[model samples]
Target: MRTVFVQIGEIMTRTPVLVAGAGLSGLSTAVFLGMHGTPALVVERHESTSTHPKARGQQTHTMEALRLVGLEDAFVAASPKSRGFALRIAASASGPVFHEILHDTFVPMGHLSPAASADASQEAAERLLLGRARELGADVRFSTELVSFEQDSDGVTAVLRDLRTGEESTVEAEYLVGADGHRSPVRTALGIGTHGSGSIAHNVLWGIRADLGHVVGEEQVLYYLQNPELSGGTGVLVSTDDADRFVVGVGFDPDTQHLDDFTPERAVEQIRIATGVPDLEVEILDRAPVETGMYVADRFSSGRAHLVGDAAHTMPPQGGMGGNTAILDGFYLAWKLAAVLRGEAGPGLLDSHDAERRPVGEWIATNQYRNAMVRTGARYDGPPPVEDPATLFFGYRHNGAVVSEPGDEHELLEDPNAPTGRPGSRAPHVVLDSPDGPLSTIELFGREFVVLTGSEEWERAAKSVAADLGVRLTAHRIGDGLTGPWAEPYGVSDDGAVLVRPDRFIAWRSPGPGPATDLERALRSVLAR
Candidate 1:
């Protein structure tokens, strides 16, 4: 094992931003701040990488967020290419029922640009992002715990402890961000309350790395089994990067004597029973009992301190929005902090973090609850049944403060049919031709606002706005050969244009009559006017 050490009593001075917790949210936030030339310090209690793969599912929006930071490929590599979701329902009596199968496909680069190719492109993109973050020089401290913090008008002072040496020191920063998990010290210190219900029930998540043989097939599968003694439950089969090792999760409530019991042995037995192949052998690599809970923080920010990731909201694993939402939180907050630190935006810019993110958090909580209800058969009354699984993945619309016009009411969009991109929405992934070579739309985002104008008229307007605002902007025109169906899905015509914020949401759009004056106004509203 390798280690990087920071000297104790060195008295590190104030950075523009101090982030506690170096997990996905903290690291992603630090990377974004660093890219904008704002010094950021991240402290983590853990000494090394966390082996607990609690949250593994990364949605398309999450992938886009990583691309903004230049780590899309690493994330993709870490993630298994899951088409859609498979639902298995267990009944009080009878065998398990396979209820739903959703198929979603990944878009290749050729659709966006001829330069973009599928061969090793995803891997290359991930590595590039990881490397870029490292190059930006973020101060990432591991094995350090944040003991406490004090905030003044000028800056925030934080006390940190070195777990390895048992030494304590204080560092100062202009702002503090809590990217910590559910039990957030910052949330506690700030007296921020979490508003929501407790876990519907406690369930132990048993994870196994095994070769379940080819009978399960390459695609992900869910199995719901019914047993007289044990109500109904579901088991998930997730394909991993390693061909020989497949990750499996089984949910079991301790209160109920489902299957066998809530023990590891019982979990394995349940898997066997659900699969209905007693002869099929599986190797149990690791297992842990996970307490599932759902809650949202009352507020995402207070004064100069802000919360992202689990600190802001926590949802059950049924929906798989925990990690994805955390990543999105990092993206939404990083730029606003950067703007304030750079003196390019006002402090009020930070307020939008709560305004824009809280709605998303609430939506996730509701969706997760719905998913749990569907799995447990708690509430069967709702919209008519649909066969499409993709609807769950891309059907959400951003109806928060960021989205001025959410349009008409609609249910969540199912998978493959979901729109690629829209205003105040996550920017869709598209391959485009750059001077150097092929690039992903995600590759072009981040650090600063990006005005993706499809026409020459909007392109000129983008330049004027970038110049007037004194912000870096990348303006590009959609060429004839570069157009694709994904573009139309975003509701942008060949003559239309879109202004993507530093966070990659469409800040403004135009149909090419002329650049809307409100484009710059909206940027100012979100950034600094």
Candidate 2:
């Protein structure tokens, strides 16, 4: 329910969704909303999309979300191709390579993922998302800032100010999203507090163009070079587009060593220290000071306003998961918002975002702290843990109205390497052939709730319930000449059915043929009709 109001001094506008920020999280949410036929107005205080190359690692899970909206190939295309498999960590830039901190052998990430992973710069991803969102009819406004907002039972009324013209206007939206980054003003305006190891560190990120082929001997994506002469003493070299183009990030303490200590000229000098080259010519492309930390908001939503990305959770740059997880936040919230706005689901559906993603965010933050420990060479109390990339990306679950109750903590996250179709887990990726072509079980989801069953009677019952409920439900009967017995892994009998939500997460499953009343009650309970 929304009640529109126009204040005397503010220009009035309206959009179903108002996204406050144009970063990866905000833009992706807008794009996914547009894909679902919901128009959103995206506001960014910046004049244009960011060119910074922070958080360049896009995990397969992120790519899966991008694939759902048809941006996976484009995202992968813009990534840097690895010239070699080993990531070299050395005492100095010019010394013998000491150890391979990371390797290419473990990087065949696509096999473990539904799609594949990519090393695309954050800026490149933003550019592509901006174009796609616009194409899908989102009204994206740069140089516009969401100054203030108020929400009641019906909707949100936000005051947006154009930074360039100093013009302020009011917009009424059914829902509002805050993806505005770690220093989220929207989260603050809503009186949301965050808790965690807040101040992890700080850094000055320099995107530089320099010739380091002699030092590396081959192309590599990451280099952790240690040199005592440089500011912060050690820094990570991340690959950019060209072999010569790279981003160097040096973390410093604001209290003792200042960020102002690292100037453009000083940055180049430090780059030479890391590369072991006394005098290397380096061109500075972009520079930005980022305050790195770990924190998660106490709440993800207040009234009709919700938070995603850095606004909802913040973590260090250890695993390069900050942006990737942000993309996931957008993905989880977008479909739920779309369903509610399209009148296919009730507002209770929105509650799942917090129940699901907030836990994931906390887990990610805790793991990121482990990464920081590795960087410091501090011995863990027990033993150092390996950062399992695939496990971190896909092994998470939420139990609530949208999903069947999970078994236990161990069962909650099934083996990432061998994911079974467990209730409350992401639906297993099954390649089934369709009349049009081969389709993934994932491809059959997102636009509507789907029923996967081999029994004709189950199919008939699903269709009957769908029609009666007036829900966008698709029942895919197995063994229609294009499939086989795929029920063993799902714990489903031949006549059983699995109900998947639009986001490809298992909602409910019947072990065998159930009475029509039972199926209807399950559907009604999930849909909140």
Candidate 3:
């Protein structure tokens, strides 16, 4: 609970959600909130969307989240079509391979999900999200900064400043979100401390435009350069969204070398050495010094203020889960905030964000830190095991009051291949046929509570519960819009029903015909009514 305050003669704009930092997490929060009919005011100090291609890989779960909003096709189309896959360690792009990390035959998981993973630049994704947010009535202001904020018991009162004009205004919001990247001032103001391997190493990121199609071939490759001439004796080279564009990462020791040491001439020479081409023409697009580290905030939420993306967790770039995790943080938080703000849930529902996501952040960051250590050839006493991509992407399990029948001995990750529609697990994706065509069960969520069952009695019970609870609940008989065998996979009998949250996570499941108050009790508990 947070209180709101205002001063006389001060201009104030009221929004249910006020988001700080217009990076992937902030934009995602705004877009998802808009999808739920809760328009948020997003403030960014930058003049526009990111120009640099920050994170390039969007995992399968991230694609699924984007699919809920119908942006999956656009994202897939924007990504480069690779002819092959490779992740190798070599002296240079054209040099002999020192080691082969992963060389597997890529297979599509169309049977598992309606959405497939793709690699799209962050800039392109942000552009599409910005368009969708605007269409959904989100107020996104560029060149604006969240100066400061305070929260008490009812809401949050924030001061925003226009960086261009130096004009300051007040914003009163029911909830505040900080998606303001790793060096978040919002996190600092909240006195939230982070814990993990603080700084793994320091490196320079160089965004360059170079035609390496002939040298690197059509394979989607990650080349770890081990040329001794380069600083730190190692670097990374990977292709970008543009055919002629690429990005490079060169490690440097701060104790000996500095940013000033990497001059324009030195950059060209280093790029040539890393490519094994003495006469290659290269155009430097951007350069920045980056700190590779693992960080997870001690808490995800404090009062009405919450943290997402880098503000909540930061990790090394080895796992490609940084941006994907950020998108999920927004997805998970937005729905909870929307429910509470819409008066469909009590304030206690907000507490679930920290419980559900903080563990996830900690796990991901720790794994990524170990991966980075192993990849960079740093010495570590513990052996780092590679996690299955499916498990990392889809195997989350939640617990607490929101989920019915949350058993003891809760495991954080489950095997997605073994579908378990238990309470607090991701709803199993089932392909069901409709008059429109065949669609996955994943398509039936994202807006309101959904009941999936084959029995007419279960459907009627759901309707009755909706009427009693006064919540937006929709019931779909298995044979109606969706035709499929869902009971066994859903861990329910033919007459049983499964209740799914707006995010497509299972809240409760009835094994067979239950009491008339079963569904009502579940909804009441889930919503903290």
> Per-residue alpha-carbon lDDT of model 1 for 436-525, expressed as tens digits?
666667665665777665677777777887788886777866673344333565567767776777765666666445644766776676
How high is each candidate's TM-score?
0.75, 0.92, 0.95
Model 2 regions lying over 4 Å from their true place: 1-10, 84-88, 93-98, 109-114, 263-265, 378-386, 403-412, 433-439
**Higher-TM-score candidate among 1 and 3?**
3
Task: Provide the overall lDDT of each model, using Cα atoms, as 2-decimal numbers.
Answer: 0.62, 0.78, 0.84
Each model's number of backbone clashes? 13, 4, 7
What residue runs in model 3 are displaced by over 4 Å at the alpha carbon? Answer: 1-9, 103-107, 404-406
Ranking by lDDT: 3, 2, 1
Sort by TM-score, top down from the best = 3, 2, 1
Cα-lDDT of candidate 2? 0.78
> TM-score of predicted model 1?
0.75
- How much does each candidate deviate from the true structure in C-alpha RMSD? 6.2, 2.8, 2.5
Q: Model 2 — TM-score against the truth?
A: 0.92
* lDDT for each residue of candidate 2 in 410-511, tens digit (9 for 90 to 100): 343556567667667777766767787766666667667888888898888888988887777888888875585467766789789888877777888888
Superior by lDDT: candidate 1 or candidate 3: 3
